[model samples]
Target: MKILVCISKVPDTTAKIAFKDNNTSYDTNGVQFIINPYDEWYALVRALEIKESQGGSVTVINVGGAENDPTIRKALAIGADDAVRVNTLASDALNTAQNIADYAKKEGFDMVFCGKETIDYNGSQVGGMIAALMDMPYISYASKMNIVESKATIERDIQGGKEVLEVEVPFVLSAAKGMAEARIPNMRGIMAARTKPLNVIEPSNTDYMTEIVGYELPPAKGECRFVDAENPEELIELLRNEAKII
Candidate 1:
């Protein structure tokens, strides 16, 4: 079972987000980057678990430039046997997915896994796109998966409950919470990752459907409005007029 786990580089959750170039680009200066939380904690870990049980390999893939190498190294440290960096500047979801799908198709991986969405972009499209590109079965928001023989049993989160799906090998799945527990890299793992194979590959020609014109932070919060607990009239008026709760 060769599992290809797609990881993403994202700003650390605590990083302060700001825009530059008249809000045309993110101001990465003074910001810390990390492996996307969902990818690191759920998707990659789940793939590692599957590999441990089935005795195979887990490879991490990312679409980014040199700036993302550190986070890619981190993923390798966590348990991925190797890493592949699609050398590109594209941050668009579609283009990224296309590049990954192209690589997966040629590599002939048995399973491809990705997080439900990257924390930074919050675009839940890659897994489905890859499945579409490969014309393979797709299971999004999968919280659990088990492989038996040549088939896979996947449990996905649906609107109100969960859905279990059985699909053949060579499929794509987007992992969400409950897939697996997060693992911090140990000293041996970290040291070994420094020398692990990190292949850099150029993305095949793929037309980008969109480009980011700019980025803007959400508006700052307004001054807090106090509610009078002893005065019922004030509370009602505030809710109806100011807060618009009614």
Candidate 2:
């Protein structure tokens, strides 16, 4: 099985987010980046597990500038056979998916995987877009999968309960939580990753279909107010009129 896992670089959750150019873009200065948690913990690790059990090669692909190489290296250390970095900073989800889909098509990978969403944007659109561009079956939020002889049975969450579905070899999946456990890179893996193949390729398409208007942080928490515990009706009024919960 030839598998391709899509990875992304995201600002560390603890990093203080700020906007630049009048709040039109993210300010990356002094921000530490890491492989998106969903990508690393579920998508990439599950891909590695599949490869280990099925005796196939796993390749991780990223769409970003040269600065993304460090995150790509981290993916390699987690047990990917090789990595591909599309040398382009994608402005939107479409172009990012387009670049990845183009590469997956050229490589003819049997399976394509991605995290359900990126922490920074949380769009949860790239995987579906890639599946569309490649014209393959797409399964999102895949939690568990069992593969045998070019067929796979995948489990995912539905509206109220879990849903299990089956797909053939050539398909796309966006991994969610419970797909797999996260793996830490040991000294040996880190050393091997330094020599692992990090293939850099130019993006096939650079046209962006979307633009960022602006970004703003969520409103800060308001001051806490107290109501007399002995007066239940007053609390009800507060909830109904002030907090609006009722």
Question: For model 1, what is the C-alpha lDDT against the true structure?
Answer: 0.90
Clashes per model (N, Cα, C within 3 A): 1, 0
The estimated TM-scores of all candidates read 0.94, 0.94
Model 1, 155-181: lDDT tens digits are 999999999989999998999999999
Candidate 2 segments whose C-alpha is farther than 4 A from its true place: 227-237
> What is residue 118's positional error in candidate 1, in angstroms?
0.7
Which candidate's lDDT is highest? 2
Clashes of 2: 0
- Itemize residue pairs with steric clashes in candidate 2: none
Question: Can you write out model 2's per-residue Cα lDDT over 15-40, one digit (the tens) per residue?
Answer: 99999999999999999999999999
The total of clashing pairs for model 1 equals 1
